[model samples]
Target: MKLTAISALVVLSKVISIAAHGGVTSWTVGGTTYPGWQPYMAPAGQKTAGRPYSSYDPILNPVAASLHCNNDGNNGPIPQSITIAAGSSITAHWAQWTHMEGPVTVYMASCGAPTCDSVRSSGLQWFKINEAGLLSGTVYKGSWANGQVLNSLEWTATIPASLRPGAYLIRFELLALHQANTPQFYPECANLIVTGSGNAFPSSSFLKPIPGAWTANDPGVLIDIYSEAAKSMTSYPIPGPPVWSECRTLKPLSERC
Candidate 1:
């Protein structure tokens, strides 16, 4: 149980990420079209609980946020956006849903807070979502989205080392839904932990767990993330020059849990 902040690893480049993070979006997956499926959860009922949903919600932390059903891309705050050093590799892995028990489709893009309509290259990565075991049909195998695009689920791109930091959001739009009418789905919002080059946390080496998988109901599991534990940089200060314009991204549900 250790908290790891990827940004706080070491101050090197520019600053980015400035917006409020509501909290994480959650999901429990199930489908048969694919071999073993990833975990997916859409808003199951008519109404959603809204913010203040998770005690550890990033919105409360301000540096992060989350959205669910009725979650239109009409300009929502971003949670867990941070700065990065040059030449850093940012990666992620996810699964999408077309229907409850069918294939899932997910699209990705790189945009800032005020306007997140910017579309970046996306991955065709596929993962099983049909009530599969846990991970890719293995233990700890559940992931959101349904494809085999590795870069899609996991992103590993290098920051320009001279890129600027600002408001950004990783839009997770659902191509399919369990029901047709409501254009909303579940969320497992990711918590971004800053890390310096070579996974270094220079500040005080403090590791604090930021709970991501908790719901309004259910027991809680915690994973500690170490940021600039000490007052190294300003609260969510922007990263320096040479940045990964769209590289600022997220983590997995199981790892957070």
Candidate 2:
């Protein structure tokens, strides 16, 4: 999820500097003004009272990512979304000036009707792990679509072959994060999906819960953990955005728990 100056909030975060206000700092969202606890932005209408939070500013496709202040703690997404193509690769980068003494792992899922990385599409076999689990490798998640190729880690990676597409879904997990002298906040999440081409694929036959594990994401799908050697991303779905409760339902979709 990227943020662009949509309404009052976006404008406030970008413009109106509160530097002159001493210890008190302010952040701008949609339109209303508020304190900067955790700078947040939603899909325009998703705004409300509270610390509107997000990973980074959504102005343009980010060319650089901060492993130090990302969601490794409990604020940002472990593996944020990105658009990629067929026959390509995407990597996850972190570890600069933070305390996250470990690396991140990249996981791939399937799309639903539109070729998501769910169990219904190609299953876990459709996904693969490069570099195994090397944060230093830089290139963690990589694969070939059909035509073009993706060679960069991003907030959102699209499938290549912009024309002749197939079924695919991507998910990332942060096994470890930078934990230095600062306290960081982000989301402990695992929501990585992308609608594929044509119609949805078949349902995955492995839809069942593990003996000791619990999850709200798609079940039955076999996920290929790029590397068990590296640390996995921590998750904290509680106390989410206000929109989560409103949009959440006991739906029987393949993507939900």
**Residues 1-257, candidate 2, lDDT per residue (tens digit)?**
24553566767754443221111013222233332223334434432111122433211111112221222212221222233434344332211112122222232334334422123211232221221222232212321110011122222222322213443333332322122211122211222233235232223332211111222231111122233421252321211111111012333465443
What lDDT would each prediction earn against the true structure?
Answer: 0.23, 0.26
Candidates' TM-scores?
0.23, 0.28
Worst 10 residues of 1 by lDDT: 124-133
Model 1 C-alpha lDDT per residue in residues 158-237, reported as the tens digit of each score? 43333333322222222211222222222322211222333211111111111211232211111111223312321211
**TM-score of model 2 vs. true structure:** 0.28
Error of 2 at 245 (Å): 38
Candidate 1 structure, TM-score to reference: 0.23
